[model samples]
Target: MYSIVDIETTGNGIKGNRITEISIFKTNGYEVIDEFTSLVNPECEIPYFITGLTGIDNDMVRNAPKLDEIAHKILEITADTIFVAHSVNFDYNVIKNEFQQIGLDFVRKKLCTVRLSRKLIPGYNSYSLGKLCSAIGIPLKDRHRARGDAHATMLLFHKLLRTPNADKVFKSFLNAKSQEATLPPSLPKAEFEKLPTTPGVYYFKDSKGKIIYVGKAINIKKRVLSHFYDKSTKEVTLCSETSYLDYEETGSELIALLQESAEIKRHYPKFNRAQKRQVQQYAIFSYEDRNGILHLAFNKLKMAPNPLHIFYSITECRLFLESLCETFELCPKYCHLQENVESCSHYKIKQCIGICSDLSYTKEYNERVVTAIESLEETKTDYVIKTKGRTIDEEAFVLTRRNIYVGYGFVSKETSLTHLDDFENYLIRQQSTLEAQRILESFIRKKEPKILKFTAETTR
Candidate 1:
């Protein structure tokens, strides 16, 4: 049995948002068994944008039951039945968060009709409820609201059940169940319904609830679907043995990367590729003299907190620092690249800035050194680094602050530190690893990103 559900919420997020309306249809095979529907008092204003989409407003739901008032009825109707929904995660998470607020833990197996439809009926251009139904002859009476969409999805699911390959499709659906042998099991339809489309990390666990694999993706829903996109030998084997999937949403790709790194270290899932336990080895140091003249050198090191640029290995660290030194015209002797010579080897070749032997104003060369240092100090302040967004084909940005790796978030332009406090509150402190630092440095070297100054600075 399945309790196919859909909900319209005040916002997309689960933490602070509220549901405005909901619909549930309990089904057995192709027939409806029971139904429940409500317009909820979300306890907040619904944005004008959302109001236009769902035709639900604060005034309309002001007198309606708070989620707490009707949550028990929902549980009773949905009890012992699998949950089903379109683009399931939004619906599932919104409901779960609401139940959680009421001191109740609402857990259930879920199945996504979108996934089932993709496997059973391929070649549709869009999997969205309206588009899929339109392309496949399933009429949609309502586009964005709950009851209209839920009823339409139920009909589409019913049609899938009537196909010749229905048994195989159902079998795949069953296998999607997180806990196949658990007691009082709800249908597997709910879990699939709640998976989000945002970039984040996901965990896959086996029957005994041991995490087997952890992964990050630009699009969590698409990535999870891709694993089941085709039943290759590898996926087929993994699918039959898999029992549960869980995920944490990271607002930006940089945050995703940081969280993925931390999680991989913490869980050490069986299928994960082991990361190096040792700290990075590349060292950036200089050979200097009593006259305050400096020369740069690169080497692999077993020590900490010594500097020119630190990397994981001698080769990468050397190549990177060498390129910078060459670009900035620093002398070899000042960088500690050579010994006992009054003039750098580069001086003979005209590659050096001649600061070693030339009695040019000390102030000018020192200015260049300062500029170079400033150029290398990428994490010293707040800035946005642009790249391909979550969709890979679109553009996005990763935000940072004060030589610290703050969490990444998205905005169309280099958003100002108009609200640094917001950024500070949300920033996830990540390890300043050589790889991540280099990635930021490379971008800054080329674009010299516009720094957005904020009066206030805080750490996340």
Candidate 2:
């Protein structure tokens, strides 16, 4: 038994969406055994655009029974029947959520006519209820209304039941292990099956092949599957529009992280919310205090005079200062890591050499500060971080010159990455972004990958 369902919603997203109208045609594959259709008062004002689409206005449902009132009837008819809809997830999820709001549990096996048609009936330009029905010479009346669409879907389902090999297809879809019902209606199963279970970045693209989201994972296929299983509003909406899957294996999480960051910044994909904002730049610089002691401090890049080092975030700036304080045996108070303290006993930096406690050590501390500043200049040396490539025979590298991320590249293991010049031929040159800087800096600090360092002259 299958209950063909269709719903006209208030157009809000999945969780918040309210059903204004619902229709169900209970069938035993070939003929309808029962039916239920109603205009439901969502208990909220219907948007004008929704009224424009389905012609179900506030006045129409004002005296009609609310969802809570009709809830029992819907449950009774749908009991012991498979849930069927054009795009089953939408209708099924909306109804399920509505039931939950009324303190009822709605759980039913779902079958999407959209995906089923693509499986049983192939080569249609579109699988939408209207388009597919028209293509197959099925009569569809009162389009967009719940009953009309549901009834047409039932008629179409009857035809689909008789298609060749449908029994095998239906059996597999009914198996809980199969993810056919979980995927977006428009996305082909083969598109998802081809994804590699390797460390890489994957793209979620719409039917037109426009990238909507970008993500990196250690297991590309597993991570992509997770999106389909996620019930979050953003995930649901993203998966709904996703019809194509694309990816590139990097074989290293570090490279994947950098690539994911760069792609997010470059494409500015709509579904990739993070890494879209501009990264704020902060700078560390030295200034002479009233006591004639040189002090190190950080400020926004534009506000700093004679900037010594730049960082992407305030946290990074403070971390760099703390490292400098510990290395140079300088007082955290002098570095502005701690404020308004008579002496330098920063909890993390116990190695302070009494610069803040005694004025006599000013000269020595000032000299060490100069050395620290010089170290910043030398830190700009060109380097290549070696990592695993997509294939075992190749190696991946992230290149940096003058302390700026240049790009990533893949080269055959036979190539001599002994010098920075070897990277030029295979390098995929990319613009530097703050997100990329954060990714590389984080990986270097945590993983400590093999880094080949050289000066400008050495590149020759």
Candidate 3:
């Protein structure tokens, strides 16, 4: 049994957007058994571009019955059928979200004709409903509307059913065909059904409720779906052992990062990267020896609280310190990491400030160390970093105030961060991470933004 479904929505995102139209065709192995279709009053205006593409406008749906009005009929038609769609996730989510808004739960096993066709009929340049149907000699009428798409998917499903190895493919989907491998008995089907495709973090737990894995994703639903599609041994094992699922919605990726860090540390999830043990092993340190000369060094001897920077590995810490030594003209001899030479190795190359050979003043060398320290400090004044939004016209920003790393937020292209308070509120707070740092550094390095103002620190 198959329930082929298609939907037109107010928008692509699920943040409260409503569905405007829905169509479902329930079929037995070879014939249609039931059907339902409707133009739903989404209670919102369909954007002009969408109307142009789908030929569905707000005016047309103004007097149509709302989704709640037809929810029961749809439920009845699709009951006990395997949900099918060109891209089943989208259709399923739109319907599920609509039902949820009306206090109804819609859950069903799903199949994607697009993915099925790719596996069954290889070498298609496009898998879109219209493109695939045209390529495969299937008649697709009324193109973008829900009923049209659903009908096309029904044809596609029928083809898939007749394809060679179809039985094996369908069995593979049931998670039952290959072997008698048992899945986590405690896992509820509802867990996978409700995971939204928005940015967030997810946790996997065993039968005893201990978190075995924790991960962050830009889209929770897609990431989780990936685990299911994966044929790898790790994914198979993880799926089998995943008895519980939990998630947190972070409105932004920065928040997700901070939360992931805190949670990983707090729970110490078993499957997280093994380098957790090396977090504190490497650090940048500033020290003044008995002679009252300041020195910057990469320290790996012991865990110390005076680290100017932290890294996951000693090699990375040493490389960065070495680069800084050249860039800031710091003497290597006083750094205590180099062995034996009186003048230090860099003096031969004239890269050092010569403090090691007593040619450069201690005060001058110490000033450069202070300059580097101040450069690394998060104490700079107000600044802004803008990035692309999920949509074309929208834009997002990471706002920094007096350089304490305040927060980030989004705005329209016409909006500016001129008002300090409003901009601050938009700023989302994020914990410092190599990821965020690298993102910012790469963005700044590329010279892409409008460049309101940005200044790299200099060794004073």
Candidate 4:
């Protein structure tokens, strides 16, 4: 038994949405055994746009029965039946939420005519109720009304029941383990199933093969599945338009982060918002205190005079400063990590060396501060960072020329790479980006990287 259901809502989304009108057709496979249709007073003013699309105005449902008044009838009619609808999740979730608000539980085994039609009927330009019905010659009347759409969905479901191999398809979709009911109607199961559970960057593409969003994950399959389950409006819309998926596995998470940023910039995917915003620039600078202690600190680029090193985010600035503090054996308090404190008791930096307590020589500390600042302004030498590759037999290396990121490449472990010039043959060159720099610096700050130096003569 299946109850074909549809509802016109006062709002577009599941949460806080109230049903303005509802229609249900109780069917035993081939024929309708019972039916129910009613206008519902949602107890809220319907938005102008919703009224425009649905044609159900405040006047129409003003005197109609409230949902709580007819809740018992709904429960009785849908009892012992599987719920069916076009783009079923919307209708099913809206109704389920309505029931919950009235202190009732509505749970039913669900089926989507759109998903089923795509699987059983095969090639069609669209699976939306109106388009699919018109394409198949199903007479659809009173376009957006609950009864009209629900009736059409029932007829479509009847055709799907008779299509070849539909029994098997229906069985698979009904299985408790199936994600068929959760995925967007336009996306194919195969596209999602092929995703690898490895570290990588994934792309969500529309039907026309344009990249719409890019993301990196330690487990690509798990992360992509999370998007499907998200109920946020933006996430739901992005998933609805995603008809395909593409990915590239980078064994190292650091490499994945770099590649993900590069792809986002190159494609400028519409759904990628975080990387599109302008990055804030920070600079490390030095100053002398009342006690003649040379302190290293960071500020916004415009505020810092004679800046030592620039970074994209405050995190990068702090990380670079912390590294200098630990290396120079300088006081964290003097470095401005802990402001206005009498002495340094930093949790991360315990290498104060008594400078905060005035035991160390001011001249010696000033000299080390000079050395740290000079290191920051020194010219970047050509180098290579080697890490794990996509496959076991290969290794990956990121190249830089004079401290500017060149690109990354993979090489066979059997091939000996002695210098930065040796990686040129395998180099897949890329443009330097602020995001890439931040990611690289963060990785270097935490990990002891395999840094290989190259001289000019080696390349010649």
Best by lDDT: 2
Between prediction 1 and prediction 3, the one with superior TM-score is: 1
For model 1, the stretches where C-alpha displacement exceeds 4 angstroms are 176-460
lDDT of 4 at 139: 93
Alpha carbon deviation, residue 298, candidate 1 (Å): 21
Q: Score every model by TM-score.
A: 0.45, 0.79, 0.45, 0.76
On residues 1-460, what C-alpha lDDT tens digit does candidate 1 reach at each position? 9899999888745566688999999999679999998999988889999999999988899899998999989999999988888756456666887898889999987767766776678776567788889998978887788899999989988988788798876775567453222211111334545778898898777756787777788889788766654334344335434556789876555556666766776677766665525455767665445665554566666553356455676667756765666777776566555668987774333467678777564556666666676677653465555444444434444566655455565443444545666554434455655445655666568757655554344322
Flag the better candidate by lDDT, 2 or 3. Answer: 2
RMSD of each: 19.4, 6.7, 20.1, 8.1
Q: What is candidate 4's lDDT per residue for 1-460, written digit by digit as tens? A: 9999999988756677899999999999999999999999999999999989999999999999999999888888899999998878778878888888889999999998888988898889988889989999999998899999999999999999999998899999999999999887788899999999999999999989999999999999999999988876678779878899999998888889989988888898999997765577888888888888888988998899977777878998998899989887878887888998888898888866677777457888788888887777566677888999888999898988767688999999999977557789999988666888778888889997988877777655
Clashing pairs in 4: none
Report the candidate with higher lDDT, 1 versus 2.
Answer: 2
Q: Cα deviation of 396 in candidate 4 (Å)?
A: 1.5
Using lDDT as the yardstick, the better of models 2 and 4 is: 2
In candidate 2, how many Å is residue 204 off?
A: 1.7
User: What global local distance difference test value does model 2 have?
Assistant: 0.90
CA lDDT of 42 in candidate 3?
88
lDDT of each: 0.68, 0.90, 0.71, 0.87
Q: Between the candidate structures 2 and 4, which one is better when assessed by TM-score? A: 2
- Flag the better candidate by TM-score, 1 or 4: 4
lDDT of model 4, residue 288: 87
Error of 2 at 337 (Å): 24
